[model samples]
Target: MADREDKNAENVAGKFYVDSQCIDCDLCRETAPKNFTRADDEGYSFVYKQPESDEEREQCIEAMEGCPVEAIGNDGED
Candidate 1:
Protein backbone atom coordinates (compact mmCIF):
# COMPACT_ATOMS: atom_id res chain seq x y z
CA MET A 1 0.00 0.00 0.00
CA ALA A 2 1.13 3.54 -0.69
CA ASP A 3 2.15 5.51 2.37
CA ARG A 4 0.90 9.07 2.58
CA GLU A 5 4.01 9.97 4.53
CA ASP A 6 6.06 8.91 1.55
CA LYS A 7 3.90 10.48 -1.12
CA ASN A 8 5.92 12.07 -3.90
CA ALA A 9 6.33 15.78 -3.46
CA GLU A 10 5.35 16.48 -7.02
CA ASN A 11 1.89 15.05 -6.53
CA VAL A 12 -0.88 17.61 -6.54
CA ALA A 13 -2.90 17.97 -3.38
CA GLY A 14 -5.75 15.49 -3.81
CA LYS A 15 -7.23 12.16 -2.83
CA PHE A 16 -4.91 10.26 -5.11
CA TYR A 17 -1.15 10.26 -4.76
CA VAL A 18 1.95 8.35 -5.76
CA ASP A 19 4.61 7.50 -3.23
CA SER A 20 8.36 7.01 -3.16
CA GLN A 21 7.79 3.31 -3.52
CA CYS A 22 7.08 3.95 -7.20
CA ILE A 23 9.41 2.05 -9.52
CA ASP A 24 8.98 4.16 -12.65
CA CYS A 25 7.34 1.22 -14.39
CA ASP A 26 5.20 3.55 -16.52
CA LEU A 27 2.09 1.55 -15.74
CA CYS A 28 0.30 4.40 -13.98
CA ARG A 29 1.41 6.91 -16.54
CA GLU A 30 0.11 4.75 -19.38
CA THR A 31 -3.01 3.87 -17.45
CA ALA A 32 -3.89 7.44 -16.45
CA PRO A 33 -1.87 9.85 -18.48
CA LYS A 34 -3.90 12.86 -17.41
CA ASN A 35 -3.31 12.33 -13.72
CA PHE A 36 0.03 10.52 -13.57
CA THR A 37 3.21 11.91 -14.99
CA ARG A 38 6.93 11.22 -14.77
CA ALA A 39 9.27 13.14 -12.51
CA ASP A 40 12.16 13.11 -14.91
CA ASP A 41 14.77 14.05 -12.32
CA GLU A 42 13.60 11.47 -9.82
CA GLY A 43 12.63 8.81 -12.34
CA TYR A 44 9.31 8.19 -10.64
CA SER A 45 5.66 8.93 -11.29
CA PHE A 46 3.41 11.38 -9.43
CA VAL A 47 -0.12 12.64 -9.62
CA TYR A 48 0.08 15.89 -11.50
CA LYS A 49 -3.65 16.50 -11.67
CA GLN A 50 -6.75 15.35 -9.86
CA PRO A 51 -9.47 13.67 -11.82
CA GLU A 52 -12.08 16.10 -13.12
CA SER A 53 -14.69 13.71 -14.51
CA ASP A 54 -16.15 10.30 -13.89
CA GLU A 55 -14.08 8.89 -16.71
CA GLU A 56 -10.92 10.45 -15.33
CA ARG A 57 -11.68 9.12 -11.86
CA GLU A 58 -12.16 5.68 -13.32
CA GLN A 59 -8.88 5.93 -15.15
CA CYS A 60 -7.09 6.98 -11.97
CA ILE A 61 -8.64 4.02 -10.18
CA GLU A 62 -7.43 1.75 -12.90
CA ALA A 63 -3.95 3.17 -12.63
CA MET A 64 -3.97 2.70 -8.89
CA GLU A 65 -5.03 -0.87 -9.30
CA GLY A 66 -2.39 -1.49 -11.93
CA CYS A 67 0.61 -0.01 -10.16
CA PRO A 68 3.18 -2.80 -9.86
CA VAL A 69 4.80 -1.46 -6.70
CA GLU A 70 1.50 -0.53 -5.09
CA ALA A 71 2.65 3.05 -4.95
CA ILE A 72 -0.70 4.58 -5.77
CA GLY A 73 -3.14 5.51 -3.03
CA ASN A 74 -6.68 6.88 -2.80
CA ASP A 75 -7.35 8.83 0.35
CA GLY A 76 -11.10 8.82 -0.32
CA GLU A 77 -11.31 12.56 -0.70
CA ASP A 78 -13.70 14.25 -3.06
Candidate 2:
Protein backbone atom coordinates (compact mmCIF):
# COMPACT_ATOMS: atom_id res chain seq x y z
CA MET A 1 0.00 0.00 0.00
CA ALA A 2 2.83 2.38 0.89
CA ASP A 3 4.66 1.56 -2.33
CA ARG A 4 1.53 2.12 -4.38
CA GLU A 5 0.97 5.45 -2.70
CA ASP A 6 4.54 6.48 -3.38
CA LYS A 7 4.23 5.54 -7.03
CA ASN A 8 0.99 7.46 -7.35
CA ALA A 9 2.60 10.47 -5.73
CA GLU A 10 5.55 10.26 -8.09
CA ASN A 11 3.28 9.98 -11.12
CA VAL A 12 1.47 13.13 -10.06
CA ALA A 13 4.53 15.17 -9.04
CA GLY A 14 5.15 18.63 -10.51
CA LYS A 15 1.45 18.72 -11.39
CA PHE A 16 -1.68 19.89 -9.68
CA TYR A 17 -2.70 17.69 -6.75
CA VAL A 18 -6.24 17.08 -5.63
CA ASP A 19 -6.33 15.93 -2.04
CA SER A 20 -8.63 13.22 -0.78
CA GLN A 21 -11.00 15.98 0.26
CA CYS A 22 -11.98 16.82 -3.30
CA ILE A 23 -15.70 17.10 -3.92
CA ASP A 24 -15.63 16.67 -7.70
CA CYS A 25 -16.73 20.25 -8.26
CA ASP A 26 -14.76 20.65 -11.52
CA LEU A 27 -13.88 24.27 -10.81
CA CYS A 28 -10.26 23.60 -11.55
CA ARG A 29 -11.15 22.41 -15.01
CA GLU A 30 -13.43 25.38 -15.55
CA THR A 31 -10.66 27.73 -14.48
CA ALA A 32 -7.80 26.08 -16.35
CA PRO A 33 -9.15 23.82 -19.04
CA LYS A 34 -5.81 23.39 -20.73
CA ASN A 35 -4.07 22.15 -17.64
CA PHE A 36 -6.92 20.39 -15.85
CA THR A 37 -9.37 17.72 -16.93
CA ARG A 38 -12.17 15.81 -15.28
CA ALA A 39 -11.58 12.22 -14.32
CA ASP A 40 -14.16 9.92 -15.87
CA ASP A 41 -14.78 7.83 -12.78
CA GLU A 42 -14.95 10.58 -10.19
CA GLY A 43 -15.49 13.72 -12.23
CA TYR A 44 -12.75 15.33 -10.13
CA SER A 45 -10.11 17.56 -11.58
CA PHE A 46 -6.62 16.28 -12.39
CA VAL A 47 -3.64 17.98 -13.89
CA TYR A 48 -3.07 17.45 -17.58
CA LYS A 49 0.30 19.13 -17.52
CA GLN A 50 2.45 21.13 -15.16
CA PRO A 51 2.17 24.71 -16.30
CA GLU A 52 5.34 26.06 -17.88
CA SER A 53 4.47 29.62 -18.96
CA ASP A 54 3.46 32.57 -16.85
CA GLU A 55 -0.12 32.61 -18.14
CA GLU A 56 -0.56 28.90 -17.66
CA ARG A 57 0.92 29.14 -14.17
CA GLU A 58 -1.46 31.93 -13.31
CA GLN A 59 -4.38 29.85 -14.53
CA CYS A 60 -3.30 27.00 -12.31
CA ILE A 61 -3.12 29.35 -9.35
CA GLU A 62 -6.61 30.60 -10.09
CA ALA A 63 -7.86 27.03 -10.30
CA MET A 64 -6.31 26.28 -6.94
CA GLU A 65 -8.01 29.27 -5.38
CA GLY A 66 -11.34 28.66 -7.06
CA CYS A 67 -11.63 25.09 -5.87
CA PRO A 68 -14.62 24.98 -3.52
CA VAL A 69 -13.14 22.07 -1.56
CA GLU A 70 -9.64 23.56 -1.51
CA ALA A 71 -8.51 20.39 -3.19
CA ILE A 72 -6.03 21.81 -5.66
CA GLY A 73 -2.40 22.64 -4.86
CA ASN A 74 1.04 22.62 -6.34
CA ASP A 75 3.18 19.57 -5.75
CA GLY A 76 5.40 21.46 -3.33
CA GLU A 77 5.56 24.68 -1.41
CA ASP A 78 5.22 27.73 -3.58
Candidate 3:
Protein backbone atom coordinates (compact mmCIF):
# COMPACT_ATOMS: atom_id res chain seq x y z
CA MET A 1 0.00 0.00 0.00
CA ALA A 2 1.19 3.52 -0.76
CA ASP A 3 1.35 6.05 2.01
CA ARG A 4 -0.06 9.49 1.31
CA GLU A 5 2.61 11.05 3.47
CA ASP A 6 5.33 9.24 1.60
CA LYS A 7 3.87 9.89 -1.85
CA ASN A 8 6.09 11.71 -4.32
CA ALA A 9 5.91 15.48 -4.34
CA GLU A 10 5.72 15.61 -8.11
CA ASN A 11 2.37 13.87 -8.06
CA VAL A 12 -0.51 16.12 -9.04
CA ALA A 13 -3.12 17.05 -6.46
CA GLY A 14 -5.56 14.19 -6.80
CA LYS A 15 -6.70 10.87 -5.44
CA PHE A 16 -4.05 8.91 -7.29
CA TYR A 17 -0.37 9.26 -6.42
CA VAL A 18 3.00 7.52 -6.51
CA ASP A 19 5.17 7.04 -3.47
CA SER A 20 8.90 7.25 -2.90
CA GLN A 21 9.14 3.46 -2.97
CA CYS A 22 8.84 3.52 -6.76
CA ILE A 23 11.63 1.52 -8.43
CA ASP A 24 11.38 3.37 -11.78
CA CYS A 25 9.40 0.48 -13.18
CA ASP A 26 7.56 1.10 -16.42
CA LEU A 27 4.51 -0.88 -15.44
CA CYS A 28 2.43 2.08 -14.33
CA ARG A 29 3.53 4.20 -17.23
CA GLU A 30 2.84 1.39 -19.66
CA THR A 31 -0.48 0.68 -18.03
CA ALA A 32 -1.69 4.27 -17.90
CA PRO A 33 0.50 6.62 -19.83
CA LYS A 34 -1.94 9.50 -19.58
CA ASN A 35 -2.09 9.39 -15.83
CA PHE A 36 1.45 8.34 -15.07
CA THR A 37 4.63 10.06 -16.12
CA ARG A 38 8.35 9.61 -15.52
CA ALA A 39 10.42 11.98 -13.45
CA ASP A 40 13.68 12.21 -15.36
CA ASP A 41 15.69 13.64 -12.47
CA GLU A 42 14.45 11.02 -9.99
CA GLY A 43 13.82 8.26 -12.52
CA TYR A 44 10.49 7.32 -10.95
CA SER A 45 6.87 7.24 -12.04
CA PHE A 46 4.20 9.51 -10.56
CA VAL A 47 0.57 10.27 -11.23
CA TYR A 48 0.76 13.47 -13.24
CA LYS A 49 -2.89 13.66 -14.20
CA GLN A 50 -6.17 12.53 -12.76
CA PRO A 51 -8.55 10.43 -14.79
CA GLU A 52 -11.51 12.27 -16.24
CA SER A 53 -13.56 9.38 -17.62
CA ASP A 54 -14.50 6.00 -16.26
CA GLU A 55 -12.23 4.21 -18.68
CA GLU A 56 -9.31 6.41 -17.78
CA ARG A 57 -9.99 5.96 -14.09
CA GLU A 58 -10.20 2.22 -14.58
CA GLN A 59 -6.90 2.25 -16.40
CA CYS A 60 -5.31 4.21 -13.60
CA ILE A 61 -6.72 1.76 -11.07
CA GLU A 62 -5.34 -1.09 -13.10
CA ALA A 63 -1.94 0.54 -13.07
CA MET A 64 -2.15 1.04 -9.34
CA GLU A 65 -3.10 -2.57 -8.74
CA GLY A 66 -0.43 -3.77 -11.12
CA CYS A 67 2.40 -1.79 -9.56
CA PRO A 68 5.17 -4.23 -8.66
CA VAL A 69 6.32 -2.34 -5.56
CA GLU A 70 2.80 -1.10 -4.70
CA ALA A 71 3.91 2.49 -5.08
CA ILE A 72 0.71 3.64 -6.73
CA GLY A 73 -2.16 4.81 -4.54
CA ASN A 74 -5.80 5.96 -4.79
CA ASP A 75 -6.98 7.76 -1.68
CA GLY A 76 -10.08 9.20 -3.36
CA GLU A 77 -9.24 12.73 -2.35
CA ASP A 78 -9.76 14.41 -5.67
Clashes of 2: 0
* Model 1 pairs in collision: none
lDDT of 3 at 76: 85
Across 16-40, the per-residue lDDT of candidate 2 in tens digits comes to 5666556767777777777777667
What lDDT, from 0 to 1, does candidate 1 have?
A: 0.93
Clashing pairs in 3: none
Candidate 3 CA-lDDT value: 0.92
Candidate 3 backbone clash number: 0
Question: lDDT per residue, candidate 3, 1-78, as tens digits?
Answer: 999999999999989999999999799899889899999998999988999889889999999899988999999897
- The C-alpha stretches of model 3 lying farther than 4 A from their native spots are none
| lDDT value, residue 66 of candidate 2 | 78
Cα misplacement distance, residue 78 of candidate 2 (Å)? 9.8
All candidates: TM-score: 0.96, 0.73, 0.96
Tell how far residue 50 is off in model 1, in angstroms. Answer: 0.3
What are the Cα lDDT values of the candidates?
Answer: 0.93, 0.65, 0.92
